[model samples]
Target: MKTKFNTSKFLAIVFIAGAITLSSCSNDDEDNNVVPELEVKTVEDLDGSQGPVFFSLSTGTAVQESATTWDIKFNSSNFSFGNGAEGQVIEGIFENYVVAPASGYSADDLAGIGSLYTYTGQAASGAQHAVLPTPGRILVVKTHDNKYAKIELISYYVGNPDTNSEAFINLETRPQSRVYTFNYVVQPDGSTNLK
Candidate 1:
């Protein structure tokens, strides 16, 4: 006897196959929904006159990309006067000094000696905004006293963006006022050198 293929059986088989295919596809779509996120390095403050103040970057804060500028802010109170001079000395009097430390002149007694000076000037506070250059490196220096005296390091560029490096400051105390000289280097990963 010859067996006949049933149309209903064929239709049922087709339906089951289509359902299985759709289920597998749906699982793949779910997997694709997951997105990878970028990892950012943490920033730590180095030691200053008072010593190192340990702190971490704010969570969820965006990492400045290469070729882009970023602004970082510090409290005015954080800065200590460089022992070099409180104010300015008089004209033609090299020996005289203004606002000397309690003890005799020592290397560490001066400002910008072992640590960066925390500038408390209006210009310094105003210039906190920064722009990230390609490869992304920036150096900023600021100087200020508790009162009226203040100095600022503005949009100063020195080297390539790829190497984000630490900037240096040469603090010179003059009779009229104090002067700050800024220099910068490129960092390895093209990030700001937080010294």
Candidate 2:
């Protein structure tokens, strides 16, 4: 006896298989497009003027400068990276940055963080003599562990006081300096994708 090919059953099986394959492909596409969340933090009252404060981008915490795990150190707006760490500065809106550059990172140099802010003098005509974060300056760091991070310096005051406010304009009432309020994103997979 010859076996019959059940056309309806064969079509059903083919349709189901195709659906499963498409579902899997769709899931993979979603995963590939997923972006890591951004981490925002403020290192308040660090008083980098008194000493250098170490920070770890990988852990999103301030580590002791002497600790070998630290990735960068902050000293009065002067940022220096740890061993084998490097960084680059780019001019653009922080939210627009997706992928960090793979090269052109300065090693243990001030070239990256040097242009982060502008200090207006007491004798300046208009705005208060405060250390203001440059409008579009962003820092991208290749961490000591070889991971990637993007930093946006938001404020240099304790509470991130409004620079235009009269309170901040007054020297006596000016928010304490050297307090870093910034947003950053670190790529945990050690890839250049900083989004």
Residue-wise lDDT of candidate 1 within 119-179, one digit each (tens)? 3233332222222111211222111111211122221222211212222221221111121
TM-score of model 2 (CA atoms): 0.81
Q: Please list the C-alpha lDDT of all candidates, in the order they appear.
A: 0.27, 0.80
**lDDT (Cα, tens digit) per residue for candidate 2, span 126-147:** 4566888888889899989999
Clashes of 1: 18
Task: List where candidate 2 sits over 4 angstroms from the true fold.
Answer: 1-49, 111-114, 122-126
What is the alpha-carbon lDDT of model 2 when measured against the actual structure?
Answer: 0.80
Highest lDDT against the true fold, candidate: 2
In the order shown, the candidates' Cα RMSDs to the true structure are: 19.7, 3.5
Backbone clash pairs for candidate 2 read none
Give the backbone clash total of model 2.
0
Report RMSD for candidate 2. Answer: 3.5
